[model samples]
Each structure stands twice: as structure tokens, then as C-alpha cells.
Target chain A: MSETIMLLCAIAGTYLWRALGVAFSARIEPDGALFRWVSCVSYAMLAALISRMTVLPLGSLAETPMSFRLGAMAVAIAVFLLARRGMFSGVIAGVGTFIALVAFA
Target chain B: MGQPNHPPGGRMTARAVVRLGLRRGVGLPSVIVMTSMMGFGSLAADGGISFLTALSASALVWGLPGQVAMAELWAAGANLLTVVLAASLANARFMPMAMSLFPLMRGGTRHRGAPYLLVQLLSVNTWAACQEIFPAIPLHLRVVYYTAFASTILVAGQIGTGLGFFAVAFLPKPVTLGLIFLNPCYFALLFAGTRVRPYVAALLLGAFFGPIIYALAPEWSLLLTGFVAGSAAFFFFDVRPTSVSNAESK
Candidate 1:
């Protein structure tokens, strides 16, 4: 029962912003002040979420050592930088590093 | 504005455009969507989230950060309000994304043809790739091209989530564990890929604040960090107009 409501709420919240965008499309500038601020907020939110998941995960991920996790992040960033900014390249590199560290060390 | 790769008179057929949209969507865009959804599926399984709940999120919510936040917060026993707020905050970037892409897509007339539903297909990658190529497309075909592209990505995304949900049974523990890292790694990569100064500033500040605030108050961390860091980045952009214009000109 509660799960259903939460799902609806989540969907509504996400669509609200998008619908608002459509409504105000003509007036809004992508790089304008409000957009920029909103962009910043969303980026910040995502960054915070990513860091939280890595540093303070709740499940199987928490079983892995911090060193392995941190090492994976470093390798991933390096690959991302070197591989023409590809997301899959970075993620694959990170996951591979994590698995390798766990297996070898 | 960037010049179109093809001339205006060159009519892009719906079939040809759909083929083109699918082909371009095949590589990084689909991979990112598939892998991220896969990670979400695995995470959902680990958290003991129901198949229906997780799949609904993939099909409906679509935004990974929001889906992940909802799952994590729910697992942490957060109330409905917290879950919604966190999820919404994570997905709020869609506004700017839609704003930028709408004007670029032919008329961009608001509420035209049930845009609310159409925007559901507007994954970040679809928007990015479309911006680069849509200008080359004839105005009449722009909507067809975007719809085809977005829907194709959506299909791949849904399939990926379903696979992830079931893969848990056959997949190795190490593989399952590794999948969870894919979403964050990709998200971080996406952040790094953005050269825009405000995004960079917000990212750095957000990274700095995430852990600090988590230690202080886990529940409020996302909201507080986002508001403070994002506002700070906005100010950073505002204060550095000269450099911004220089970068813009270049």
C-alpha cells in the first residue's frame, strides 16, 4: 500500500519538473540564472548521492573494503579522462578494478 | 548555433530517422542506460525491493539518481516524504534538460501533443545526442526523430532492468556486487564530462559537502548540500561573467 503511494509520488515529483519545463520553455533560458541554479542544485544532489553510496553504502557494496572502493574510483576517473570521456569506459574500469582488487589482494 | 551535418532540403524519412536514432543510441547512450538500470535492479534485489516496485521505477521514474535514492531511502526506513523529496531533488535536473531541448525541437510549443508523456522519453543522453544532430534534421521530422530515439532508449532501459532483476539468481556474487558500482561510476563520469563551469563548481562543492553533511545529519544531507553547494556554484558563475563569455566565445 505504502509502496504504491511512494511510487506515485516519485513519478509525480519527477514529471512535475519536466512538465514545468514544457510550460515555461519559451521563457526559460537553459543557461539563465534560474536554470543555472536548478542545474547546480541537481548536480549537487547527484554528487551527494554518489558519494554517499560509495562511502556509506547499505548492502553488499558495504562488504567490500574501502581501499578497493577508493581504488576503483581512482581507476575509473583515470579511464574516464583517458577514454574520451566515456561513461561506460569509466564504469567498466572502476568495476574491473574493484573486482580485481577483491580477487588478487 | 552548430551547423547541421545535412542540408535542410534533405528530407529525413521517419524510417531513416528511426534507424539513425536507434543506431546512434546503440553505443554509449544505451550502454549507460542499460548498465545503470542493471545496477538499480541488482541494488533493488539486494535491498529486497519487489520486482514490481523496482521495475515500475525503471519504467516510470526513469531517472537513475531518483530511483536509487528512493530505493536507498526506503531501505533506510525513511518516511514517504523523505523518499519523495530525495528522489525529486535527484531528478530536478530534468527541468533544465527539457528547457534546453524543447526550444531546439522545432516549435517546442508547450503542452503540444501531450508533452508530459513525451518528456518521459527524454533521457539525458537522448537530449544530448539530439541537440548535436537535430539541427541537421528538417523541422517537420524533428519530433519523429526525437520520439523514435527516446522510445528506443526507453525499450533498452526497460529490458536492462528486467535482466538485472533476474540475473541475481544466475550471476555470481562478485558480479552482482560489481554492478552496483556501475551507476555511481557512470554518474561521476557524466559529471566529469560536463565542461560547463557552473556544473563543475556544483559538482566539486557537492562532493565536498556530501560526506561532511552525511556525518552531521544523514537525512538532511542531500537537501542541505544541494541547496548550499548549488547556490554557491550559481554565484560562482554569476561572479565570473568575463571568463564565462571568454569560454563561450571560444
Candidate 2:
């Protein structure tokens, strides 16, 4: 079936790089050119995806008002800054704010 | 009773090291991933995906955005090829994540398939946590800790997926909204709190350009935005004279 095939492809595509990284693990220096490119691309790609998701998400998230999303993100940002990049603390704050906004507002 | 030839100060046994890794990972990092992954499961369920599909995707893919993309695209009735392409593109960052972390790990290549198995456990959360923990541990225990910690998180993720699929199935619009924001919020926080120069630059430029380009060309926006913003950041850092930074040794 198409569904099975799609899932297989998805799994393979995602795992390929991870497998390749293992294969070439000790050979690559973190600051080398290829590593730099991978690093830059990774950071850039993640940033773009995160920003886009926050700014313009899909599915049920698209249903929520952008104001609520922005407010939640602001709270998260404040928490992240205050906690000095403690990731869970920031996410916790954002989730709490987002729930409160959605429930009460 | 067993010694594994630890580095100069490796005072703990491998079992102790593994326990420490699992204990630390089970706390904050595991909780963060569970919430996000549980949300993904709920999202997938809400999108009409079957339980099996959702579970396999999370266990196999292990990336929130890619899982979301796959679920959403599948819901939209996208072709098989489109689904694979989009999902893989979303997963591209894991390559760098794996690459950067492997060199920092210790003795993972000692056994057959150990390195590959270790990489399988290395999510963004685990990778970040390892970077924080690896520098402090002796070389001998580093591999043990890394494996235990990452696998704990991954196991937690699988359980969360099941919880989201069955227990918290079809989350109400409000909680769904909140759960969806957690992953990106985590990353945005990382961006805001980053100390590295090029990464900070890339985050800024990527944030600036992501939405504009998404509107302009949604299909290729991720690749285009990353390539442009990342390249610009790389050049900005590379071309600058390192009198203050590079000239001095670490």
C-alpha cells in the first residue's frame, strides 16, 4: 500500500543522515568546511522551521489566533531569557501561557 | 566489580555512569520531549492517522517538525514522493546534529553497531544534553552516559507517543494549540539565548527571512531560507578578522 511505502520512505530518509554520521563519525572535525556547512545549514534550517512554525503553523495550530500564539511565545522568550536558556523551563512557561490564553481568553 | 579502563579521574563504574545518565535524562529533558511528542501524537490522531502510523513515525523519525510535516502532508493527501521529500527535508538538521555530537562522544565505536545505535538515540534534546554533560565526564564513561541518557529520552518519547495517541486522543483545540507551540518555543529560546556568534547571526537572519520567503514560496522556503541565512552567517563569521576571537587560542 501507499501508506506503508510512504512510512518506509520517511523512515529511511530521516535515518540516512544519522547512519551516515555514524559511519563517518570520528573522521569529521567540527570546524572543518563540510562540518561548518552542515552546522550552519542545521542552525539555519532549524531556525527557519521554528520561526515559521511559531509565526505560521499548520492544522489545529492554524486555528488558534495568532495573538495567542505570539503571547505564548513572548512568555516563553521571557522565561528562556530569565532561566538563561533552560529549555524545559521556557517550554513550560509557554505551554502554561498558551493554555491560559486558550482557556480563559 | 568491573573496571573499563576509565580516564584519569573516572571514579564511577559504568553502571553508575549509566544510572546517572538515565536519572538526569529522565528529569527535565525527558519531560520536554514527552510533552512535545505527546502533542505530536495527538496531532496525528486528530489528523485521522492510525495509531500504528503515528507510533512508527515518532519512533522512527524522532524529529517533531518532520513528524508534523509528514502527518500534515499525509492528511492533505499529498503524493508519496511529496511526503517523503518534505519529511526528509524537515529532518535535514539531524545530520549536523549527529555529526557535531559524535566527535564529542567517547568510545562509542568500540563494538559493532554501537556507533549506529548511539546515533539512533541522538535527538536534538539528547544531543544538546550530551554536549552539556560530555565535557564534564571522563572519556571512559562518556559513551556509557551518552547511550543511557539518549535511549532514556527516546524510550520516553515512545511512551509519550502512545499516551498521546490513546489516552489524550483528540486533544481539545486549546491544549492542542499549546502542545504544538512547545517544540518551536524551545528552539526559539535556544536562538534567543545562543552565545555563539554565527549561530546568533543565523538565527536572526533566518527569523527575519523565514516568514517572508514562506509567503513568497512555501514549497522551497525551508531550503532557501536555510541556505541563504546560514551561508550569510558562515561568511560573516569566516570573513571577519579574528584578532579578538580567532587570534587568541581556546
lDDT for B52 in candidate 1 is 93
Best by lDDT, which number? Answer: 2
Model 2 C-alpha lDDT per residue in residues B1-250, reported as the tens digit of each score: 2333344446767777787788888998788788888888887887778889888888888888889988888988888899898888777677667766776664645776777776767677776667666666776677888888878888888888888877554466677767778888876775576677887787788887988898898767887888899899888774444455334221
Query: CAPRI band of model 2?
Result: medium
* Tens digits of lDDT, candidate 1, B104-135: 56453345666667788776667667766876
Write out the backbone clash pairs for model 1: none
Give candidate 1 regions above 4 Å deviation.
A24-26, A30-42, A86-88, B1-4, B7-17, B73-86, B99-103, B109-113, B127-145, B217-220, B238-250
TM-score of each: 0.79, 0.86
* Interface C-alpha root-mean-square deviation of candidate 2: 3.5
Q: iRMS of every model, one decimal?
A: 4.4, 3.5
Give the Å shift of residue B234 in candidate 2: 2.6
RMSD of 2: 4.2
Per-residue lDDT, model 2, residue A61, is 81
